[model samples]
Target: MKVIIVGYGRMGKEVEAICAQRKHTIVAKVDPVCGDAPALTKELADQADVAIEFALPESAYDNVKLYTELDLPAVCGTTGWYDRVDEFRNLVTQSSIGYLYGSNFSIGAHLFFKLVARAAQLINPFPEYDIMGFEAHHNRKKDSPSGTALSIANIILENVERKKTILTDKCDHSINESELHFASLRGGHIPGIHKVIIDSEADTIEVSHSARNRGGLALGAVLASEWLKDKKGFFNIDDFISERLKYTQMI
Candidate 1:
C-alpha cells in the first residue's frame, strides 16, 4: 500500500519507520519543514492509498480538509482543534471520505482508558471518595492538558456521576467537590504520563498509563489506516478499537 505521511516531525518519522517495516510505500510526506511534497498534487493523491497525519494543532484542520479534497482516507493524531469537529464531520459526510482521529493512538492507552473507566464506575457509588487526576508530558509539547488526558477525563466524567466539570487551572483556593482537578505538568523528556486518583480518608486508588516512547502510537496509526482504507465516514479511534474488542469478546 502506498502511504502519504503528514507532519515530518518525531511522530511522523516514527510512523515512517513503521510503514517501512510493514512494507508500505511512502508516496509523499506533507509537511513544510522536511517533507518532499509540502502539498499534495493530484498525481500524488491518486497514487496514495491512505494518509497518516500527525501534524501541528494549527495545521490539523487544513491538513484533514486536503485529504477530503483528494478523497483520501486519513488517520489523524493531531489534537487541540476538535472544536471544529462538526465542520470535519460535514466535510467527510458530504465528500464521502473517511477520517479517523484520536488523541492518543496507542493500543495500551486505549486499554488503560477502559481500566480507568471501569475503576471510575466501580467507585461511583462511594461518595466519600473524591477523584482527581494529573498528566505530565515533555516540556516541548504544544498543548497543555494533553489530548490523551482530556480523553481520559471524558471517560471518567462519563462513568463517574458526581464530577460534572474538569478543572485544569491551578486551584488557588479550595475547589468544589463536583470539580475534577485534572492538572497538567510539563517537564523534561517525559513522553506522557497520566494518573487518575480516587482518594478518601481511608485509602487511595490510582490507575495510571505511561508511554515509554512513540512506538505504540506509530503502530496504532498504521493499523488505523489499514482499517480505514475501504471505509467512508467520520470516526473516532474508539470505533476501530471497539470493533476489534468485540471480536475478542466473541471468542
Candidate 2:
C-alpha cells in the first residue's frame, strides 16, 4: 500500500519508520516546513491508497478536509480540534470517502477504555466509592487534561451515573458529589500516563495505562490506515476494533 504521511513531526517520523518496516511505500511526506513537497495536492492524493495524519491541531482539520475532498481515505491520530468533527463527518459522507479518528491510537489504550467503563459500571451501585482521574504527559503536549484523559472521563461518566460533570481544574474547596475531578500534570519528556482512582474509607482501586513509547500509537495508525483503505464514510477506533473482533470470532 502506498501511504502519504500528512505530518513530518515526531509522530509522523515514527509512522514513516513503521510503515517502511511493514513494507508499505511512502508516497509523500507533508509538513509545515517549507520545501517539504510544497503542498498536498490532488495529484499527490491520487498516488496513495490512504493518508495518515498526525499533524498539529490547527492544521489537522484542513489536512483531513483536503484528503476527503480529493476522494482519499484518511486515518487521523490528531486530537484537540474535534469541535469540528461533525463538519468533517458531513464532508466525508458527501464526498463518499473513508475517515477514522481517535484520541489515542494505542490498541491497549482503546482496550483500557472498555476496562474503565466496566469498572465504572461495577462500582456504580457502591456509593462508598468516589472516583477521580489524573493524567501526565510531556511538557510540550499542547492540550492539558489530554484528549485521552477526556475520553476516559467520558466513559466513566457514561457508566457511572454519579459523575454528571468533569472538572479539569484544581479545586481549593470541596468537590461536589456529582462531579468527577481530573488533575492534569505536565512534566519532563514522558510519553503519556492516565489513571482512574476509585476510593472509599476501606480501600482504593486504581486502573491505569502508561505508554512506553510512541511505537504503539504509530503502529495503530498504520493498522487503521490498512483497515480504511477500501471503506467509506465516518468511523472511529470502536468500529475498527469491532470488525477485528468479528473476524477473530470467525477464525
Candidate 3:
C-alpha cells in the first residue's frame, strides 16, 4: 500500500515506521511547514492509494476534505474536531470516497468500547448502578475528555437510556442528568488511560483500556487502509469486526 502521511509530527513518524515495517511505502508527507491544502498537487494526490491523517483538529478537516474531493480513500486518527463531523460525513457520502475514522485506532481500545457497550446493556436493568467515566492522556493532547472517552461514553449512553447526558460532576445539577458523569485529566507523557466505573450500594465495577504506545493503532490503520482499497464509503472498526464479533456470539 502506498500512503500519503498528513501531519509529519510524532504520530505521523510513528505511522511511517509501521508502514515501513509492513512493506508499505509513504510516497509523500503533508506538513504545515510545507504548504496548506492549496499547495497539494493533483499528481501528488493521485499518487497515493490512501492517506492516513494524524493532523491537528483544526487542520484535519482540510486534509480529509482534500482526499474526498480527489476521490481518494482516507483513514483518520484525529480527535477534537467532531464539531464538524457532519460536514465530513457529507463530503464522504457525496464523493463516494472511502473514509474511516476513529478516536483511537488501537484494537484494544475498540474492544474496550465494545465491552463498555455490553456492560451498559447488562447494567441498564439495575438503576442502582450509577456510571462515571474518566480518561487521562499526555499533556500535549489537545482535547480534554479525549475522544476515546467520549466514544465510550456515547456507547454506554446508547445502551443505558436512563442517562440523558454525560458531563463532569462539579457538585451541581446543571444538565439534569440522573446517572452519568464524565471527567478528564491530562498530564505527564501518558499515552492514554480510560476507565468506566459503575458504583452501587452493594459493589462497584470498573472497565478500562490503557494504551502504552501507538504501534497497535498504526497497525490497525494500515490494515484498514488495505481493507479499503476497493471499497468506497464511510466505515469504522466495527465494519471490519462485524464478522468476527458475530462468530464470537455463536461461541
Residue-wise C-alpha lDDT for candidate 3, range 1-251, written one tens digit per residue: 88888877778788889999989988788786642432445687788888887878988788777887787788888877877888888888888789988766787888788789888999999888888889888889886777677788789889997897777545465445454688888899999999999888999999988888988888877777787788888787677656456778921
Give lDDT tens digits, candidate 2, residues 1-251: 99989888889999999999999999989776832675789989999999888888998778777886798899999887878888888888888789999877898898788789889999999999999999999989888878889889999999998889999999878999999999999989999999999999999999999999999999999999999988988999888976886888821
Pick out the ten consecutive residues of candidate 2 with the lowest summed lDDT. 30-39
Q: What is the lDDT of residue 116 in candidate 3?
A: 90
> Number of clashes in every candidate structure?
0, 0, 0
lDDT of 3: 0.80
| Runs off by more than 4 Å, candidate 2 | 32-36, 246-251
Q: Of models 1 and 3, which has the larger TM-score?
A: 1
Candidate 2 global TM-score: 0.89
- Name the weakest run of 10 consecutive residues (lDDT summed) in model 3: 32-41
- List residue ranges in candidate 3 displaced over 4 A: 34-39, 172-177, 247-251
C-alpha lDDT values of all predictions:
0.89, 0.88, 0.80
- The per-residue C-alpha lDDT of model 3 at residue 81 equals 85
Pairs that collide, model 1 = none
Query: Which is superior by lDDT, 1 or 3?
Result: 1
